[model samples]
Target chain A: MALTLETRDLTIRFGGHVAVNGVSCTFKPGELTAIVGPNGAGKTTYFNLISGQLRPTAGTIFFDGADITQLSAPLRTRAGLGRAFQLTNLFPNLSVEENVRLAVQAANGTHYDMLRPWMVRRDLIARADEILDRVALGNRRQVTATALSHGDQRKLEVALMIALEPKVFMFDEPTAGMSIDEVPVVLNLIAQLKQDASKIILLVEHKMDVVRSLADRIIVLHNGQLVADGKPAEVIASPIVQEAYLGVAPGRSAA
Target chain B: MMILSGDPPRSRVLSILLVVIILALAATPFLFPGAKAMNVAAQICIFAALVASYDLLLGYTGSVSFAHTMFYGIGSYAIAIALYSMGPVWAAVATGIAVGLPLAALLALAIGLFSLRVAAIFFAMVTLAVASAFQVLASQLSWLTGGEDGRSFQLPELLRPGTVLISKSLIGFELNGRVLTYYLVLIAAATMILCLLRVVNSPFGRVLQAIRENRFRAEALGFRTVFHLTYANCIAALVAAGAGMLNALWLRYAGPDTSLSFTIMLDILLMVVIGGMGTIYGAIIGASIFILAQNYLQALMGAASKAAADAGLPLLPGLLHPDRWLLWLGLLFIASVYFFPTGVVGRLRGAGSAKH
Candidate 1:
C-alpha cells in the first residue's frame, strides 16, 4: 500500500508562541511537495512535527492511516519517515564510507549483534559504497566526514538518507549551502529519487527555480497557517504568495 | 592468529608496544617471581582489562558513567562473598560469576533506562549518584558485605599458593597454585580485553560510535539511540565486572579501597584519556604505564632526590623528595597530555599513518 501522511489541526507552542499553529495537510505517495514559505513561517516546524522531533502541543499526525503523533524519532524513521537536516548533520569524525555503512547497517537491523565483526559484512559495505558512488563521493569514501567540503558534506547527508531508503524522504533544504557547481549533483539526485512511484518527497526549498523544476505540487505556508495548496504555477501566481513570499505586489504578473 | 582482534593496533609501533605489554604480563609469574612483582603484574593485567572496558563507554560511546566501579565492586564482592560463605569451592566461584554478571547487567539496564531517557549529563549524574549509593550500601551492610573491612576469603585448593601444579621447577620457579593464580588472572584479563576489542569492531560497536558522533543523525538513520546506549552500558558493565572478578581472584580479597573506591574510577578516566579514548589498545598501554609508574615512579623520584642531595644541589633534594611523587606524577600526566593530546596510542597511530 502506498504510504500516506495526514496531520489534523497540528499545532506546537514554545513559550506561548505558536511556532506551528493549527495547520493540517495530507501528503500522498508519488507527489513531491515543495513547502514554500518565508522564514519562521512554520515550514520546518511542520517538518519537525511530522518527523517526531518536537511534540505537537495540540494535534495528531497520521502515517499510513495509523496515528504516529507520539512515535519517537527513530520509530518514525523505522516506520519509513526519513529526515535530513538543513545544517548537514552527520558523523563528523567517521569516514564518509563508514558513515554510510553505519546507516546501511542500521537498516539491516544488526545493531544488537556484537559477536560478528562489521568488516565481515561485505554486503553492507558494498551497499554503502554503491550509495557513495551514486552521489559521486566514492573517491572520498575514506575521508572523514568533517574533512569534506560543505558541498560534499551536503552530499554525504543525502547519501545517508539514500542508504536508509525510507518511504518518506524529507529534505529540510537539500541545496542550502551548495555552490552553483554542487547544486546540480543534489538536485539531479533528488530528481532521480523522485522517479520512484511509491516514494513521497517533501522539500522545503527557498530557490523558486529549484522548486519549479522539481516540485510536483506546492503548498504555501504563511504565519503558521496553510495559506494556499496547489500546483507550483498557481501557488506562485496566487496573490498570497505573490505578496507575502515573492515580495511582489498582489495580481502582478511574473517579471 | 589475529592477535589484537577486530582492528590490529593499526600502527606497527603500537602493535609492538602492545605485544611487549602482553608478553610481560603473561610472563609476570616467572620473570618477576617476588610477591611484590607478582602483585603489580596482576594489577597491570586486571586494571588493563578494567580500563579497556571503561573505554568502551567513555571512548566508543561517549557515555561517562561513574558507576563502572560499582559494577566492578559487585563482581569482586560477589566472588569474595561466595567463596567465604560456600567454603572456597570451584562451583562457588562459578556461582559467583554466574550470579554477579547478570546482576551487573540488570542494574546497568535499570540505571540506563531510568537516566538515559534524559540527556547524557543526566545519565552521568544518575550513575554517579547510584554508584556512590551502592558503595555506601556495601559498606554499611556489614552482615553481608563485611562492612568497612570488606571480605577476605579462602580460594579453591587449585588456586591456593601452596597447591603445586607440578613438582618440577622450571628455571627455579615451580608451577604452583600461586603461579596458577597469576596466570589465570593474566589469561582472563587478556581474553576479556581481546573480547572487548572484538565487540568494538563489531557492527554494534559501530552503532555506539555513531551515536557518540551524532545522536540525532544516528536516530534519524533509524537507530534506537537509547536502546543501543543502554546495551552498550550493559556490555561495559559486564566487562567491568569480569575485570573485578579477576581482581578478586588474584588478590583473594575485595574491599572499598581495592575495588569500590572512587579513585579507581578516576584512574580509569586517566587511563582512557592518557592511552587514547576510542582505541582499545590504549587501555593496555594506559594501564601498564599508570600502574607501573604508580608502583615505581615514587622510588625513582626518591633516587633522584638522593642523587640531588649527594650532589648538594640547593632546593633540588627537597623539591624531588619521595613524598612529592604525586606532584611529579601530576606533572608527568600533564606533560603526556600536552605532548600526546590524543593519547599515546593515537599519537603512535597518527604518526604511522602520516608516513604513508
Candidate 2:
C-alpha cells in the first residue's frame, strides 16, 4: 500500500489532563512535516500515538486507507510506521555494527532462523555496514553502542530507523544532544531522505532553524491542540504559534 | 567455529579452562574410579547442560524464569512414571522424552506468550507461581508422580550397573554399566551444551540478546519481541528437560528434592552468576565448581576447623566448622560477585581485550 497517514481526533488523557487532545491531522507522501511545539505540548505524545506506543483515549489512525488504531507497536512498525525514540533507545552492550545488524536481520525476517550462523549472514552484514558508512559510523563498527558519543548514538539511531525502511519515517528529536558540527550530517541525511517521493517524514524538533530549512510544511501544536498547519513561513509567522510556542504571554500583544 | 555458530569463548584462559574441565569430565570413570566420583562427574555433566539452558533465558534473553526446575521435574517425573508403569525399556525413555520435551515446550509457550505481554518482572513472578504450583501438583498427584517419595524406577537392562562392559582393563576401574551411563550422560551433556552454543550464536540468539539489551528498539526494528522471547523460552525449556532426563537416568530415580527443589533453582542461579551470566562456557565452569564445592566444602572446612582448634585460633575454629560451610559459601558467592562482576568468563574476556 502507498503511504498515507491520518489521525481523526486523536485524544489521550492521563486522569484529568489531556496530553494530546483531539489532534486531527493528515500527512501526505513526498513531503516533510515538522511538528513544532513547546515543552509538554504533546508532540512526542502524538508521535507515540501514531507509532502505536500509546493507545488513544478517543481516536483512530489510518495508514493507507486502513484503520490501524488497534495495532500493537511491533505490528505498527511492520506496517511501515518506523519510529526513532527521543531518548535514543539502543542495544547498549551490542557492538555498533551488531546493533545495525539486528535491525537488518529483523527486516530480513531471518531473526528467527535458529541454526543459521549470525556472522555468516553476509547480505545482512553488507547492508549493515553500508548503513554504518552512511552514518559515518563505519570506523566505529566494532565499538559498543553505549560507548559511542552522543552525536554518534543519534546517527546510529537514524541508522537503525533506515534499516527498517519504513514508509512513514517518524523521528522524535533526531538531532537532540548532537554537537553543532554533527548537526549538518544528520540534517543532510534527512534532506537526502526527503528526495524519496513515496515516503512521509514527520520530525519533531525544537529548533526553528531546522524547521525553516527542512520542513515543507509545519504544524504548530499548543497545549495538546493543533493550532496552525501550513507552509513553514505562514505557520511560524502566525501569532498563535508565536504566543504558544515562543513562550510569549497570550494576554499581552507580540512586542 | 561453525559448530559454535562462529562464536568462540574469545579468551585463551577461558578456552583452556573449558578444555581442561571437559577433558577431566570425559575421563572421570578411568581417572577418578569410585562410585562417589562417578556420581559427582554425572552431576557436573547434567548440571552443566541444565545451567546452560537456564543461561539461555536469563543471560541471552534477559529473562528470569523460576519455572525452569518445573520443566526439569517434568522430564524426571515423566521418565520415572513411564519406566515404572510401562516397564524399564528404551521405548519408555523415548516415550518420556517425547512427552516431556513437547510438554515443557508447550508450557513454556503458554507462560511466555501469555505473560511476556506484560513485562519481564511479571513473567518472572508468573514463572515462580507456576513452578511452585507445579511442585504442589506433583506432590498431590501420587498415582502418576509418586508424590513426596517420588518415583524410583529401573534403568534399561544395558544400564543396570551390574552389567560389565569390560571384565579387566589397564585403566584401574571396571568398565561397567555405571561407567557407560556416565559416558552416556557426558555425551548427551556435551551435545546439548554444544547445541546451546549454536543456538546462542545464531541470528535467533542475536535477536534474543538484542531484546535483552533493548526490547523497545527491537520492536521498532519490526521484530515481534513476544514471538522471539517465547521461542527462546521454549528452547531453553527443552534443553532443561533434556538435562533432567539425563539426571533421572543417572540416579535411577526421580524425586521432588532431586529435581523440583527450589534449592536446585537457587543453585542454578548461583552457578550461572558464579560462572558468568551470558557465556555457555560459564555454565560448565560454574556447575563444576559449585557442585564440587557443595560436595567437598564441608569436608575441607572440617579439616580446616581441626587445624584451627589444634592451633587454639579461638573464633577461627568455630568459623571453619563443617556446619558453617553455608556461611562460607555465602561469603564466597559475595566475594565472586565483588571480584568478577561479569562472572569468570567476563573477567577473562576483559583480560584478553586489555592485552590487545
Candidate 3:
C-alpha cells in the first residue's frame, strides 16, 4: 500500500499546554486505521491538525506526497481531505437536500456559477440524491438540518463528507452522541468506505468494539504521544496501552 | 407560470404582484400627468433598485456595510462631473459609468479585503468609518463635486425635459423629456431587478446564502468563503452605482444630501427591514411604501396643523406641525419592527421558511 498521508514531528501548543506533541505517522491507502486513547489523549486535536482546522506549531503534513503544511481548511478540503466533525457541523437552516447539494456542487466546481439557476444543474442534484439515499436520509430530504434527529444529523454529516469525493476521510468521533441502535448504522457506513481500494479512512473512536471490528490496524496515544502501534490484538495486549487505560500496571488491581 | 411551477403558490402570486407593480410604475406619468406624482413614481423606481442591490450584501451574503451610500455618491458625482466637464453627450454618460463602477468596485474590494478579516459587527463599524471619511472628501472636493452645493449640469438633448419625442399626445400626455426620462429610469430599474433575480437563484447565490447560514460549514465544504463574499460586495456596489447614475440623471443634481447622506442608508435599511430582508421583491414593496409615506405624511401633518389652528387650539397645532413628521415616521418604523419582525414579505411567505 502506498502512503496517502504522512506527518513528521507534528506539534501544536496552546499557551502552556501541549495538545499534540511530536507525533509522526503514515497512513496507507485501503487501510482502516483506528486511533484510540484515554480521555484528553489529544486524539481529536491530532485529527484537527491533519484536517487543517488547527495549524501545527511545528511540523510538516504531506498529502499524496506533496507538502501541504500551510494549506487552509477549505484549500485542504479541495485538495481531497474530507472531515466529519465530532459535533454535527451543518447548515442548520438549509434543507437536508440543500446541505448535500452544496457539498456536491462544491465537488463539481459549480459553486461559482453566478448566472445559471441551481435547479438547472440536474446532474449535481441527481448525485446529491444518490448520496442522500445511501446515507438513508432520502425520506427526510426536505427537512431542515436542525430539524433532524441527532442520529440523522450525524448521518447528514457523513453524507456531506462522502459528497466531497475525498481521497482521505477523517472522522472525529462519528458516533459521539449517537444512541445505541444508531451506532451500527454509522459503523456500517464507515465500514463501507473500505470498498474503495485507493482511499484511506481514519477513525477517532472511543467504542472499543467498533475499533476491534472495523480497524485494519490500531494506533494508541497516551499523553499526546503514540504509545503503541500494531494489529488490534497485539496493541490491546501491550502493557503501555493497558496501563494507560487501566491507570496501573496490567497485573496490578485497584485498591 | 410554467417557469414558476416549481415554486410555492405564494411565491407565484408574489411574482405576479411584482409584475403588476412594475407595470403600474411604468404607466404612472401617463396616468397622473402631474409633475409631483411623476417625481414620486421615479423615486420608487430608483429606490427599488437601490434597496435590492443592498439586499445582495445584507440579506444574501450576510454582510452589513455602511459604505453603500458612498458608492451611490461616487456614481452620482462621476456622472455629474463628467457631464459638467465634457459637455452633455451620450459618450459622457458612458464615460461616467465607466469611471464610477470601477471606482465603486475598487473601493468595495479594498474594504472587503481588509475589513472582512474582522468579525461581522467590526466590519460594519469599519465601513461606517470609511463611509464618513468618503463623505467628508466629497464635501471638500469642491472643484470636482461642487462641494456642499453638489453639481448639476446639462443632459443630452433626448434626456432634457424640453425635448419632445412625439408631436401629438399619446394617451392624453405629451411624449416629452420627463416621460422619456421616466421610461429610462423604468427600463434601467427593471433590467437590474431581472438580472439580480437571476443572480440570486444561481449556484453562486446558494453559496452566498450558505455562507450566511454557516460560514464555517461552507468553508469546510470547500468553498473559498472570503472570495465569494468579496465578489458579492463588488456586485452589490456595481448595482448600487447603476441606481445612483439613474438618480443623478433624473434629478439633474448629485448633492451630498441627495447621494452621500447617511439618511439614504438609513432609508435603505428601513426599506429592507420593513419589506423583508432576504426576498428581492421586498425592496419594491418597502421602497414604495416608505417613499409614499415620506412624501404625503408631511402634507397630512400640515393639513391637521391648519385644522387645529383654525379650531383655536395653538399648542395642538404646534404639536401637529409638519416639521415634526419625522417623530411620527419614527413611531411608524418602531411599530413596523414590533409588529412585523420578519418584515412584510416575511409575513407574506409565512413563518417556517423565509430565506427564498
Candidate 4:
C-alpha cells in the first residue's frame, strides 16, 4: 500500500513561537487517521502544512511521491487534496446545486465555453445531484446556500469537496457547531468515506467519542510536538496521553 | 436531477421584449421624421452601449472602476486621429478598438496587481486618479486632441454590401443617409447586447461571477483571478471604444465635453443603476430613462420659462435649469439608493415571492 500523505520532520514557526516542531508522519491510503490534542495543540497547523496552505519553516511534504511543500493551496486541491474549513466557505448567494456544479465544473475544466448551457448538461447535473445525495441534500438542491440550516451547510461544504473527487480528504472540526442529532450524520459520512480503498481521510477533531469511534489510528501532540501515535485504544490508554488530558496527574510530568 | 434548464419563463419574456424593442428602435427614424429626434436617439444608443460595456466590469464582476471614461476618450482619440491622418472610417474603427483595448488591458493588469491591496473606496480613488490624469493630458495636448475644443472628423458613410446605388435602401430605409447612421447604431447595440449576454452566461463569465462573490476563495481554487479580471476589463473597454467611435461619428467632433466629461460618466453610471446593475436589460432601460428625462426636462424648462414670463412670476433658479440635469440625476440616485437599492429590477423581482 502506498502513502497518500507523508510529512518528514515538518516544522513551522510563526514569528517567535514554533507552532509545529519536528513532526514526522505518514498517512496511508484507505486509513482514517485522526490528530487530536487539547486546545492550542497545533493540529490545524499541521493539517495546513500537509494541505499546502502554509509553508513549513523546515522539512518536506510528499503527496503521492511528489514534493508539494511549495505548491499552492489550489494546486494541492487539483492533485486530489481536499480541505473542509472550520468555518464554512461557500457561494452564499448561488443555489445549492449551483455551488456543487461550480466544484464539478472546476474538476471537469469547462471554464471557457461561452455558448454551452451549463445546467442543461445532463451528465454534469447528474454528477452534482449524486454528490448532493451523498450528503443527503438532494431535496434542497434548488435552495440558496444561505437558506439552509447550519447542519445542512456543513453537509453542503462536504458535498462540494466530494464533488471534486479528491483522493485525500481533510476535515477541521467538522462537528464544531452541530447539535447532537447532526453530529452522528457527519460522523457516519466520514466513516463511510473512509471505507473506500482509494480515499485517505485526515481529521483534526477534539470530541473524544468521535475520535475513538472513527479514527483507525490516533496521534496526539503537546506544545507542537508529537507525544503519542498508535491505534485509538492504545494512544488513549497511554499514561502520557492520560496525563495530557487530565492535566498534571502525579509523577507523569516528572517522568 | 432537476430537469429545469434554460432561462426561467420571465427571462424568456424579457428576451422577446428586448428583441421587439431593438426592432422598434431600428424602425423609429421612419416613425419620427425629424432628424434631430433621430440624432438624439442615436446618441442614446451609444450611451446605452457604453453602460452595457461598463456593466461587464461594474455589474457582473463587481469591480467599480472610475477610469472607464479614459478608455472612452482613448477610443474617441484613436478613431479621430485614424480618420484624419491614417485611414478610412472602418480602418479608424479598428484602430480605435486596438489601441483602446491593449491600453486598457495593461492598465487593468497594473490596477489588479496593485489594487488587490485595497478595495472599495481606495480602488475607486486609484482608478479616478488615472482617469483624471488622462483628462489633464488630453487638455494639455491641444495639437493632437485639440485640447478643450477637441478634434473634428468627417462623418463616414455606412454602407450595405452588394449595392453602390447611393440611395439604395434596406428594409425600406436608405443606407447612405443620416437614417443609415441610426440603423448602424441600432445594429451595433443589438450585436453587442447579444454578445454580452452570451459572455455572461459562458463558463468564463461564471468564473468572473465567482470572483465577484469571493476573490480569496477563487484564488484558492486555482484560478488566476487577476488575469481573468484584466481580460474582462480589456474586452469591456474594447466595446466601449466601439461605442465611442460611433459617438464621434454621430457628433462629427470629439471634444473634452464629448469624451472626458464627468457628465458622460454619470450618464453611463445612471444607465447601469436605473436599469438594474447586474442584468443586461438594465443598460437599455437606464438609457431610455436618461435620454427621455434629458429631452423632456429641457422642453419642460423652456415651456416653464415662457409661461412664467407670461404669468409675470420670477425667473426659474439656475438649480432648476434644464441644462443642469445633474441635479435631477443626483436626486434620482439618492432615491434609487434609498428606495430601490437594487434598481427597478429588484422591485420587479420583489413583486413576486422575493425568493431566488
Candidate 5:
C-alpha cells in the first residue's frame, strides 16, 4: 500500500479557539484509519478539512501527490474525495433510487446533459439499483427519502457515497444516530469496503469496539493535537493515549 | 398497439388532454369569432409562455425573482423601438429579436451573478429593487422608451390587422391579419412550451430539482449550484422575452401598462401558484383560467349591476359595479388557494394517484 492522502501542519481557528491544530498525518491505500478523540478533540473537523468542507488556516493537503488544499468542495468531490455527513442530508422530495441515481450521474459527468432525458440512462439506473440493493434499500427505492426511518436515511447516505465510487472515503460518524440494532448493519457495510485494495477509508468514530474491529491503524487526538498514532493495540496501550483519551490507567481495559 | 399499451393510462390521458387544449387554442378565434375572444386567446398564449419561463426559475430552480417583467418589457420595447426607427419590414422584426434577446440575457446574467451571492430572500429583494429602478428608467427616458405613454409603431404588412392573407373567407371566417397574428402567437407559444418541457425533463433539469430540494446536498454531490442557477435564469429570461415579443406584435403597442407594469408580474406569480409551481403544464391552465376570468369578470359584474339597478336597488348596483370586479377576483383567488394549497395540477395529480 502507498500513501494516497497526506495532510501537513493542518490548522483551523474560530476566533481565538483552535479547532484543528497543526497536526500531520498520512492515509494509505488499502488501509482503514480510525480517528477517535473526545467531544472537542477535532476529529470531525479534521475530516472536514480533508474533504474541503472547511479551509485550513495553515496547512497543505496532498491527494495522490497533487495539492488539493484550496479546491472547493464540489471540485474536491470531482477529484475522487467522497464524504457522508454526520447528519442525514438528502433530497427529501426525490425517491431513494433517484437520490442514488443523482450521485451516480454526478460521478459519471452525466448530470450536465440538458437535452437527454435522465430516464434514458439505463446504465446509471442499473448502477443505482446495484448500490441500492447493496445497502438493502432496493425494496424502498420508490419511497421519498424523508419518509424513511432514521437508520434507513443513514443507509441511504452511505448509498449516495458508494454511488460516487471515489478513491477516498471520508465518513463523519456513519452510525452516529442509529439504534443499537441498526448500528451493526451500517458498520458491517462500512467494514466491507476493506475488500477494495486501492481505496483509502478515513473514518471519524467514537465507538471503541467498531474502531478496534475495523481499523487497520488508529490515530488518537487530544486537545486538537495528535496524541497517539499506531496500530490499534499499540495506540490503545500507550500510557499517554490511555491517560489523555481513555481516562484509564495503562494495562487496564478501556472498553 | 404494444407501444400504445406501454404508456400508463394516466400519461395517455394527460397527452390526450394536452392535444385537446392545443387544438382548442388554435380554433378559439373561429369558434368564438369576436375581437374580444381573439384578444383573450392571444393573451392566454403570451402569458402561458411567460409564466412557464418564470417557473424555470421559481419552481425548478427554487429562485424567486421580481424582475421577470423587466425582461418582458425589454422585449416589448426593443421590438417597438426597432419597428419605429426602422420601417415595417422583416429586417425590423429581426432587429427586435436580435436586440431584445441579448439585452435580456445580459441583464439576467448580471442580476444572477450578483444576486446569487446573497441569500434567497435577499436575492428576491435585490431583484425587486433593480426591477423598480428599471421601471423608473423606462418611465423617465422618454426619448427611448416613450415614457409612460409607450411607443406604438407600424408592424410589417403580414402582421398588420388589415392585411388579409386570402382573398376569400375560409370556413365562414375571414383569413385576415388578426387570424394570421393568432396563428403566429399559437406557434410561438406551443414551441416555447415544448422546448421548456424538454429542458425540464432532461438531466440538467433533474439537477435543478435536486438543488431545489437540498442545495447543500447537491453541492456536496459536485454540482456548481450558482452556475446552474444562473444558466437557468438566462434560459428563463430568453423565453420570457419571446413572450414579450408576441405581446408587442399582438397589441401593436408597447405601453408601460402592457409591458413593464408590476401588475403583470403579480399576475405571473398568481398564475404559477394557482396552476402549480413545478408542473410546466400548469402554466397554460393557470393562464387560460386567469385571463378568461379577468376578461369576462367585468362583463359579468356589469350585467349583474344592471339587474340590480332594474330591480330598484341603487346601493346594490353601486357595490356590484364592474369597477368592483377585483373584489370578486380576490375572493375567487382566496377560495382557489384554500382548496388547492399545492395548486390545481398538484391536486389533480394527487387525485389521480389516490384513485390508482
Candidate 6:
C-alpha cells in the first residue's frame, strides 16, 4: 500500500504531562484507519499534531513523500490534507452553500479575486453543489449552517472537507453527539468515502461497533502509547486491548 | 469546478452600489440650485468618505482603535504646515497622506499586538488612552501645531487664467474662492471612496475578515493577523488623511483643538454605530446624519440667538449656545442605542433584506 501520511517518533508533551508519546504510524492510501482509546488517551492530540494544529515536541511527518511537519494548518490543508473538528467549526452565519464555497475558494486559491462576483462563476458554484450533494446536503444549500440539525451539520462539515478534494482526510469524533439512528447515516457516508482507493482517511472513534463496522485496520492507544495495531478483529481480540477496555487480564472477569 | 468564482458574493453588490453612489455624488453640485447647497453637499461627501475609512477598521476588521482621529489631525496639520510654507495643493495632499499613513500604521501595529492580548473593553481603553495622550501633545506643541487658538493657512490660487475677463468668470473659475474648494473636496472624496472599496474587496480584506471572526483559526491558518490588521489601519489612515487635507483646505486652517480631540472620536463612533458597524454604506449614512444634524441644530441655535437679542431679553445658553447641540446629539445616541441597535442604514437594509 502507498503511504499518504507517515509519522516518525511523534511525541507531544504539555510541560510535565505527555499527551502523545513516541509512537509512529502510517496511513496508507485507499484505506480508512481507526484510532480507538478510552477518554484522555491522547487520540485527539495525535490528530492535532498530524493536522498542523499542534507542534509535536519530537516528530517528523511526511505527506505524499514530502516533509510537511512544520507547515501551517492552512498550507497543509491546501497541500491536500483536510480535517473536521470534534466540535463543529462550521461558519455559523453563512448559508450552507456559502460555507462550502469558502472551502472551494480556499482550495482554488481565489481568496483574492475581488472584481468578479462569486455566484457569477458557474464553475465554482457547481463544484460546491457537487460536494454538498455528495454529503447529502444539496437540499439544505439555501439554509444557514446554524439552522441545520446536528446530524445535518455533521454532513455539511464533511461536505466542507470534501470540497477541498484532499488526498488525506482526518475526522475527529465525527459521530460524537449523534443519536443511534444518526450513527448509521454518518457510518454509511464514511463507508462510501473509504471506498475511494486514492483517498487516505484517519478517524478517532470511541464506538467499538463503529470501529468494527468501518475501519479496515485498528490502532489501539493507551496512556499515550500504541498498545495494539493490526486488523480490527485481531486488535480487538488482543490481550492488551482486553486489559485496556475491561481493565483486567483477558482470562479474568471484572466484578 | 471551484466555488465562489471570482470573489465573495456581497462584494459584487457593494461595487455596484459604489458606482451608483459615486455618480449621484458627482452630479450633486450641478443638481442643486445654489452655491450654498452645493457646498453643503460637498461637506456631506467629505464626511461620508471619512466615516467609510473609519468603518474599514471598525466594521470589517473589528479593531476599534479610538486614535482614528489622530490620523485625521495629522493630515490636517500636514496640510496646514504645507500651505503655510506656500506649498502647492497637490504637494500638501500627498504630504498629508505620506505623513499620516506611516504614523497610523505604526500606532495600529503597536496597539494590535499589545492590546489585542486583552481584547474587547480593555483594547478600547488602551486606544482611548493613546488618543488622549496625542491630544495633550498636540496642545503642548504650540510652535508646530498652533495650540488651542488654531493656525490659519492662506489659500493658493484655484485657477490660473491668462487674463481675467469681466463677464464669464464664475466664483470657482475666478481664482481664490470657496466654490473651488468645494469642488476639489467632492473630487477627492469620490476618489478616496473608490480606492477604499477596491482595497476592502481584495484578498487582504478577506484575511482581515477571517481574523475578525476567529483570531486563533486565522493564526493557525498561517495568517499574520497583526500585520494584516496594521496594513488595514494604514490604508484607513491614508483615506482619512485625504479627507482631512480636503477639510483643512475647505476651512483654510488647522488647530490643536481639532486634532486627537475626544469629541471627534465620539462623532466618528456615533457615525459608524448609526450607519451599521460592519457594512460599507453604513458610514455614508452615519456621516450624512452627523453633518446634517450638526448644521440643522446650529442653524436653529443661531435663529434663537437672533430672536433673544432682538427682543432685548437675557439670552439663555440652553436655547442659543452651539454647545447645547451636544444635548440633542446625546439624545440621538440614546435613541440609536435603544431603538436601532444595528444602525439606521443597517436597520433599513435588514428590513429590506427581510423581504427576501
Q: What interface RMSD does every candidate have?
A: 1.0, 1.0, 1.9, 2.4, 2.9, 4.3
Best by DockQ: 1
Off by over 4 Å in 3: A1-3, A246-249, A252-255, B1-17, B168-171, B302-321, B351-356
Q: Show pairs that collide, candidate 5.
A: none
lDDT of 2 at B106: 98
Q: Per-residue alpha-carbon lDDT of model 6 for B115-227, expressed as tens digits?
A: 76545567678878987888888888887777886668766654222234332356443333554566678878877866666666555566566667666555434444566
lDDT of 1 by residue, A1-255 (tens): 658989899998999788888888999998999999999899999999999889999989999979999899989988889888888899999999999999898788777888878888999999999999999998998999999999999999988888888999999898997899999999999999999979999999999999999999999888888899999889999888999888899867755
lDDT of 2 by residue, B54-80 (tens): 999999999999999998998888888
**DockQ of all candidate complexes:** 0.84, 0.75, 0.72, 0.50, 0.61, 0.29
The model with the greater DockQ, 4 or 6, is 4
lDDT tens digits, residue span A82-154, model 4: 8877788888878899888777877776656656556556677789999888788899999999999998998
Clashes of 1: 0
Native-interface RMSD of candidate 2: 1.0
- Per-model TM-score, in order, reads 0.97, 0.95, 0.94, 0.87, 0.94, 0.82
**C-alpha lDDT values of all predictions:** 0.90, 0.91, 0.88, 0.76, 0.88, 0.74
Misplaced by over 4 Å in model 4 are A1-3, A246-255, B1-24, B87-89, B97-99, B106-110, B113-126, B157-175, B301-326, B353-356
Q: On residues A1-255, what C-alpha lDDT tens digit does candidate 5 reach at each position?
A: 364899999999999999989999989999999998889899888988988879999999999889999998888999999999888899999999999999999999875687666677789999999999998888999999999999999999999998999999888889888899878777888878888989999888888888999999999988889889999999988898888888898778787
Write the candidate numbers in order of decreasing DockQ: 1, 2, 3, 5, 4, 6
Residue B166 error for model 5, in Å?
A: 2.3
Superior candidate under DockQ, 3 versus 6: 3
Model 4 over residues B1-356: C-alpha lDDT tens digits? Answer: 12112433144444464556566677677777676678768877887788888998888888888877877887778777667665446777677667765766677668766774446567678888988998999999988888888887765455322233355354564444566666777788667766776677666777778878877555555556666676677777777777877777677678888888787888788778887877766777678777867777677766676676667676554445667665776686788767877766545545544454
- Candidate 6: give the clashing pairs: A124-B2, A124-B3
List candidate 6 segments past 4 Å from native.
A1-4, A57-70, A114-122, A179-185, A195-198, A246-255, B1-40, B89-151, B159-177, B198-207, B217-228, B301-324
lDDT of 6 by residue, A205-241 (tens): 9887888888999998888988899998888878898
* Off by more than 4 A, model 2: A247-255, B169-173, B304-321
**Candidate 5 chain A: worst-modelled 10 consecutive residues by lDDT:** A110-119
lDDT of 1 at B205: 91
lDDT of 5 by residue, B71-138 (tens): 99999999999998897888999999999999999999988888885578977998899889999999
